[model samples]
Target: MKNLLSLLTIAFLSTGVFAQTTWKADKAHSQVSFGITHMTISEVEGLFNEFDATIEASEEDFSDAKYTVEIEVPSIDTGVEMRDNHLRNADFFDAEKYPKMTFVSTSSEKVGEGKYKVTGDLTFHGVTRPVTLDVWHRGTVKDQKGNLISGFAISGEVKRSDFNLGPDFPEAVLSDKVVIDVDAEFKKA
Candidate 1:
């Protein structure tokens, strides 16, 4: 019984030691931007300035990664303050009603050495949809603070009408498709 107890303690300690790797978003260094067609001739670009992500993976690979992302829709900037304000209103994001958007990963599949196909449920404007993001793992390294960091870039497109985005603009000027791009940096948590 003494030998068994000792072995169990050693196993528990080893598990804790091996679970040291963790990654968290460096919000100041991350960005989430989106673009969509405007009048079929110009593209309107906007970015959400406040967002964060959490990541946990083993040193061996990102296959075991778990990710959760949250974004503040009211913090969107389109370079034009007027347009940005309108976007935050009821016609678009309705920031007052749905102040935030989020994505929680459901599954991830490795398609290449540093590339993955991630499927998650994206909640926006009081609606949720299953979206797939093409994710590229840029790599991992140590930051100036001596913390481990991981970088990733993801891009995907979703239909605005599917989320009840607009009611005034004509289909010609406002395409249903919106392209989203994310450049995220994660640090050791």
Candidate 2:
């Protein structure tokens, strides 16, 4: 009976030591994109070609997730070289001054079934502001290679004027609100 108690104690202690879990971006299957209204009539879409994100926690309750994401500002692509170049200047994203836009989650709440309201501060163009993202946890699956993968659909909006990244004529030339979306997949790391 003493031996049995000793073995059980060891097993319990070992489980705690190995309980930490980390999720890393599966970049090839993840994407970050944004859209903004143009001329009060049309919309312009773009994407960041380079980004990295991660989810870390003791368990799979993403409401307790430690989330961080970084996006390369210069990687913004609108499928037009000239437009992309123009956006990288001081008048816009100013990739030279702020090479990356980042989001580090401060808190999360389970707002509904399979949905979470993630509140975080987004830093962009030398400015930082609080933003809330509506995140939907798609599901988790184990692949043929035995790697566990999880998916999330996230969307949020930021005011360009708040970050001093807007055109002078925000109402006439472009809208103040920019909508961001991410279809992200992460693998157990």
Please name the candidate that would achieve the greatest lDDT relative to the true structure: 2
Model 2 residue 114 CA deviation (Å) reads 1.7
lDDT of 2 by residue, 97-167 (tens): 89999999998889997799999999999899999999998989998999999999999998898899956
**TM-score against native, each model:** 0.89, 0.91
Q: Report the lDDT of model 2 for residue 15.
A: 86
- What is candidate 1's TM-score against the reference? 0.89
Candidate 2 structure, TM-score to reference: 0.91
Q: Which stretches of candidate 2 lie over 4 Å from their true place?
A: 1-18
Q: After superposition, how far is residue 70 of candidate 1 from its true place, in Å?
A: 0.9
Candidate 2, 67: how far from true, in Å? 1.1
What is candidate 1's lDDT per residue for 32-80, written digit by digit as tens? 9999999998999989998878876764468767678899999999999
- Once superposed on the true structure, which residue ranges of model 1 sit more than 4 Å away at CA? 1-21
| Pairs that collide, model 2 | none
- Pairs of residues clashing in candidate 1: none
